[model samples]
Target chain A: MAALNIKKGSSSHSAYDLRDFHSQAERSHTLALIVDNEAGVLARVIGLFSGRGYNIDSLTVAETDHKGHRSRITIVTRGTEAVIEQIKAQLGRIVPVHEVHDLTVESAAVERELALFKVVGGGDKRVEALRLADIFRANVVDSTLESFVFEITGTSEKIDAFAELMRPLGLADVARTGVAALSRGA
Target chain B: MSRTMTGAKMVVQALKDQGVEVVFGYPGGAVLPIYDEIFQQNDIRHVLVRHEQAAVHMAEGYARSTGKPGVVLVTSGPGATNAVTGMVDALMDSIPIVVFTGQVPTFMIGTDGFQEADTVGITRPCTKHNWLAKDTDRLAGIIHEAFHVATSGRPGPVLIDIPKDVQFATGTYTEPRQARVDHYKPRLKGDIEAITRLVELMESAERPIFYTGGGVINSGPGASQLLRELVDATGFPITSTLMGLGAYPASGKSWLGMLGMHGLYEANLAMHGCDLMIAIGARFDDRITGRVSDFSPDSTKAQIDIDASSINKIVHVDLPILGDVGHVLEDLLMIWKSRGRKTNRAALAGWWKQIDAWKEVKCLSYAPSETVIKPQYALERLEALTKGRDRYVTTEVGQHQMWAAQFLGFEAPNRWMTSGGLGTMGYGFPASIGVQIAHPESLVINIAGEASFLMNMQEIGTAMQFRAPVKQFILNNERLGMVRQWQDLLHGGRYSQSWSESLPDFVKLAEAFGAKGIQCSDPAQLDDAIMEMIEYDGPVIFDCLVEKHENCFPMIPSGKPHNEMLLAADAEAFKSGAALV
Candidate 1:
């Protein structure tokens, strides 16, 4: 939660400053949810965000339990502290949701995303693309006479940095999976 | 050994086991099997409504009036779509209701067969929980679970989309006790330490106030009695939200009246000035909070609710106790009594004195009219005539609803019903009928505005057929009064399409439906007209023509704080949009 900085002489109730109530500093939070692995469960989770006007930057979900019938969804969203708290509470209200863990606040969590970059060029640009991939420890998954497909796995920020560098080296297209996060401790 | 039965029979049996005595529903092609099952059973009486929306509203009335879950059975596609508004209303107001929609056969569900609809998909966000019954073996258990989910925690509407094929298929019947409902269990009792802390706050607080809401009513009659006891022990002033009006007696000495937008002057002022605000069972809705930035900026706030999510969702509180309102109040009282029950009584006397001065302002006062009746005056007369009777009142949204909340004095809980959260216009009449059906000997009235009443005027026929003598007291102003009033104050009197043009003659409309009708326009004839409508043995639509230009006042206009109320006397003071801003 962010601190409320009280500005002097601006409010009648000097003890409590509320002028910036709605303008609290926005920060991104990663929430990991365990839910029933039933039909329309994902839609229910996503609909809550869209319906309540909460912003979802990225979402990834997959069935984690085969016998028990449960799925894990990791969602990265941005909101003020109050709004984030409300989002988590609202998500918990949905009947099928078993648990909601705010990995960002709960503890230091590992965040990873997988991305693929396809660079197509004839000579110098193609060599530069391969050189950058090699330097970043990205594997060249495919290659042709004019193009190379580089696969990389890292944090979202690292992936963004890789894509930014790949643009000058004739990056033709890019595809990235959303973030999947987990808490550090048991 | 469990006996097998058709899913339709199981649906009816499941409802009976849940102690559902009545169901408000409408029938169509896909629901025929269930309708046939309903027809063969006398244990569950079904009141057929003209529209699916009305069915849901009636169920809301039934649920809210009695502390039991209302049941509804509607066909798929159009039927399910039409019931969306009422479901949303129930969800917002925290009314417990289980809606069963008859879907197309499981095989032809997505193929868009006749009367097919994605009831589960469409209603998922609006309902507390929803399911599409793919197997007959799970139908009874799902129905039982639907009732459980709707009635537990923060009570809300739930839905089950049962396919026609499943209704026809045979499955083993599951008893209510056999249903696996342990997956979702709501906490019923508050933490003992937190309850003790609240008791301590009550012990030392001078300017303490109890802000209660619908959760008290939903917790059942025991909660309301416990609340009265708690208030008595603490000697704290109490105010309630619109949905929570009758939870505490309006005639009580410490009652501050209903608080919020359109709330009494003293109540809102007390809320704004209180040193300690203890919110019980009520979510601090925006309508009650006014400008959140300025809402009770000085008070040390504490909230007690069954839903943990409602605790800090809006205005943050210093104390948050999560549990059922009844259970918490009982524990709180027990702790306070055991701790020798102390309070700053001398300070509370001063607080009451200050409140009396605010009450002298009479925020509900309106200018007397000799020719045309005033809406507030009509409600006052209605209250005067029916104050001591076994009365149940429901109201359509807008000016008339606010006036009813102001004028009528309720001494008990579950006696007043309205669309407080959704503010649906067509809610009252159907709800009144539902109440009348549940309590046949009681006097049930629907306080309505003409425009709003006309939204579901077809329910009059349902009333006639069912012999549920509900009084339709329409304060006819020949205008969308609330809308017209807002336009006058905020839009420079640009009336737009706020007029109720070319309305039907209400007396004749009632006559057409084979029910009694009465019309009164003059202020002198109001009491007699209301008496006539009340004394009548059947349904009566009393069209009381009121002053067309009157506005609901003591209004905390959208962005203003509780202190900046626009009273009736100040109606002329703020005329333009700039003044409103």
Candidate 2:
């Protein structure tokens, strides 16, 4: 797992500097949402984000409990601290949403994303791709005369790094599953 | 004991169980079944409005004045779209209203059937909550829940879109008590620690001010009473937002007057200078807090509101007490009394002295003319005549609306209803009709500009038919006064499309609707015309012509700090096309 090094600071000065200066910069956060598995619930959540002009970088959802009839929706979004807090508060207010936990704020959470990269080349480029894949612990899921598909699952940052390293080595195409996150505890 | 009944019957039954006494509506093709059910019922009195938009405003007026959830019923498509403005207005002001919009049959909904609309989708952002009931079994419960959601925490408008087939289909009815709505439970009690911190700050502060808003009115009558008690006990100067007028009596000794853009000069100054600012039931709207960074630069602000999300959303506060206004005020009062009602009285006297100096400016004063009536003078005369009586005032958005806020004194909560948040132009006439319905014997007046009055002028038919006797006092400036003012000041006086051209003779128009009409231009005839309108047994439209270019002032230009407010005195030098100071 790796993290992106993004520039961080307040872009403009404010007279009433009531907020902590360090938290004013935009940062990515993964939020775990617990909601009722009901019709229109997902649309309502999506509507709120789109209507308000808030950005959602990644999202994934599925039913988590069969008996309880509850679903978990994991979303990765980037915003300032205040904006993130506002998003959490707003999500909690939706009638069908049972809970909203921001993994960045909770500080004890795991995040992972799966990616499959298809690399096509002849001699040296193909050999280097195989070597890097072994070092990154990625499996070669598919092989053809001209291409080898390497499957990798890890944090979003790690996937980004692997994809960046493979780009120059005949990386023909790539497919990624959006980040899915959960809080780690008993 | 549940019995199977048509969905339309269930809606009426649910409204009855919810204690709804009046419903403002306009019927259409898709709502025939609901209208039939309404006709068969005697418990719920339905007032047929002239337009769907007016129906929603009427409901808003009824809700704001009566402290109860206003109810509206409108048919599909255009009807739902027309009601959008009023719903947004109610949402902005935190007025509770439950609107039931008819939709096309289930199968015909997505196919663009006659009068069909995506009502739930359009209204989702504006309403506190909304639903499209596809199943008749869930229709009754949804109706009950709509009432609950609209009238509950930080009360606002909600919508329930009922398909025609659902109205015809038979479903098992659920009583209000039997409905399953356990998900929502808002915090009603204030945090004791935060309250204590606020009390300590209040007692020790030399310069403190209480800035209140519409939350007190929405928290019910008890909240206003508690607020008055708190203000009296503390002996601190108090000012309120436009929506919060009448929460504390305008005549109260401690009242500094309404604060914000177009607010009293003293109040704005107090807000800028106060060391401890206690914002009760008020979200610091941008209009109130000009230049967010520069707003109350020296104050240690504390806020108490029912909505937690409102806290720190814009202006951060030192203490945020999230709770219902009434409960929070009650707790604060108890703690203050238990601690011997401590306050820095000697320091407060000095603060009042400074406020007195600011009040001496007489920011509301204007040069009066004998031939042409001044808009402010008309409201003053209206106030003089209607004072000490059961009177409720509603206002359309613009210069006249601001003048009404400046001149009319409110002695109690719920007596003044205006479109504060969304600032919808045609709100007051229909709202006045609704208020008149609520208090049949009370004097109901909609202070409107000529252009604004024309937007919902058709509602005169509703007033005439219902015998509402709502007074329409049109300050006939013959212009969109506020827009013209902005053009005159900010837009280099370009004045594009601000004139109210080819307007009908309001007096003749009123007569056509079988209502009394009076036209007055002379200042001398103003009193008589106002009295005549008040004395009329039915609806009266009084068109009082005023000075053409009178701009509402003591104005704070948008994005300027509070201390930099431009007063009426400053307007005299700038009248000759010179730049505003």
Candidate 3:
């Protein structure tokens, strides 16, 4: 029973619809994509995600070559074996996606995102905001005119903690590029 | 080229150009500004339905009766929610309707503000397509697309959820959207080899029949003419489902009448005994087919429809032709013409003789006495009054509807408008009004029973408002005639208020609703009353009293064989088939 291969070829259909089944064992997968990082690029990708009702946990991107070149986007989403096949098939069909694969199948990749936050202060309120930012090891990029722009970089959780601390004193706004990840344990 | 005034005004103008003479709507918090703009604009009248549900139904009636798209408007939140049922009804029946609902102000959206609903998301399943117009300039184009989607192919409702802010914000709204289709490319060409096979089969078969359906009418007059040519050439026995009533003029030679639980006995028997059954644009619905395994067991079937999905989805076909019924029938006609296989009168007369005996003893089992008027007697009178003229008869659901479908022979298409699919209770009155408006010169009548007459008595005013000379025949039996008959047969007369406790005088009710009324309690009075009502310049209501619990004769109860039916007289001798008592 355990040897039953319920993969892509298990059924005659090109895809299967059994994502609702729950399992205890956790599995992880990753993929890197090259895309024209222009206006609405994010929206198109989000559309692909939402249309099939897939959930994405982490996403990170950058124009790595910087010759006004293409962008490298790393996306981390979870699914069962059948869902993974569909994701690969659907992602391959997208207009701008150069290629897609389950990196977990090939066994290699890396991913990350940077976040910045701003909070206002200049009195006792300012002192409290500074103290909270310091404990989280967030570097103070600039401080003046009753405000401070704190730069925080790390895993998403570390940035989250720093942002929470700044919130109590005078958190004004947050800018998150979300999480970007690559294949790990190469 | 010159840039025109902003998009919002163009939207209203486009609606006027599209011949959208009326819109049913109610103003709300978000749509007030657009309402103000529309109020200032020229053309396109608007009516304030008390509720959004009424707006959709009215649109449905307008679309169904006129074969044109119905347009509706409503403001957002609960207003849009109210329209869901009407949209779904239109969806089920494949009626064309364009719905415009206001959304919350763009900035105020996603907040828990007043009158905000995710209308686009909610209506996606019910509508063929929906648009959320982000700017006023695009509103005209969006409305144009909505109309196209609503009317094209197998028509269904399309909704446009307009944000209040978008309507208020100015943008260029112009562009005539040509009719564009994505998925529905129906095959018009028939499979020649398969059609040839059906022809060969039809030629060889001794007892052949044609079972036409509502799809023939939906395919338009071309479909009806092509089918009639085939029938006339072959001289085949013919029958129709309830929806297919007017496809074959009921008074024609080949017309074997309706085949169902409440269908003609001769037609039902021919379905069982026939060699080749040309199932044209008809599905084997449960009501018509009786039991699944026994449905036309001896017949070799040839089926065709515009929707490929419907083909082979129901009963199996020995020779299946998947394409538009109109084109296929034309191709079939050409094949026969090429072969020069004209009518064989001798074989046809023999079959007709057999059918005549069945019709005499097994069918047409309505008993008529001097004092007691039968439902079939009223239908016969209605038929005689029309005298085989082109007439539009819309009816409410019941025993009377069955009798009308049986006795009232129809010769025209779209001339008989009944709620065949949805069977909405109040459909008859408004639909009759809509038909009268479309065919102003033609005699239009709502052939409804007392129970159904009360359902939408208000729509009598719609006829009165337009000064339409529509005759409403309220078949008063003092009981829900069809239900009571079923209770008599099935429940041993454990009738649960099938008879009205205290029935209101519908003649007085018609007067209250601003329509002229005539009361006829006797068959002798029927002719004069009908003549006076027909000659009247305005809408008239005829409340005729008839005997209660008059069963639609040759009735096949559910789950029974179609041929095993009860005659009007001889209740116990249904199987042997009895003549009228």
> Per-model TM-score of chain A alone?
0.87, 0.84, 0.66
Off by over 4 Å in 2: A1-23, A121-124, A140-143, B572-581
Question: Could you give the candidate ranking by TM-score, starting with the highest?
Answer: 1, 2, 3
Q: Which regions of candidate 1 fall more than 4 Å away from where they truly are?
A: A1-23, B576-581
Q: lDDT score, residue A70, model 3?
A: 69
Number of backbone clashes in candidate 3? 10
Per-residue accuracy of model 3 over B446-504 as CA lDDT, tens digit each: 88887887776766656666666778887888888888977777766678878876777
Q: Can you write out model 1's per-residue Cα lDDT over A62-172, one digit (the tens) per residue? A: 999989899999999998866877787788788888788878776799999999999889788887888889898899999999899999999999999999999888889
- Checking candidate 3 for backbone clashes, the offending pairs are A59-A179, A60-A180, A109-A183, A110-A182, A111-A181, A111-A182, A112-A180, B7-B173, B137-B172, B137-B173
Ranking by lDDT: 1, 2, 3
Candidate 2's residue-wise lDDT over B206-293, tens digit each?
Answer: 9999999999989989999999999988999999999999999999999999999999999999999999999999989988998888
Alpha carbon deviation, residue B114, candidate 1 (Å): 2.7
The sequence of per-residue lDDT tens digits that candidate 2 reaches over residues A2-49 is: 111222221111111234523778998888888888766788889989
Q: After superposition, how far is residue B133 of candidate 3 from its true place, in Å?
A: 4.3
Q: For candidate 1, what's the TM-score of chain A, rounded to 2 decimals?
A: 0.87
In model 2, state the lDDT of residue B202. Answer: 86
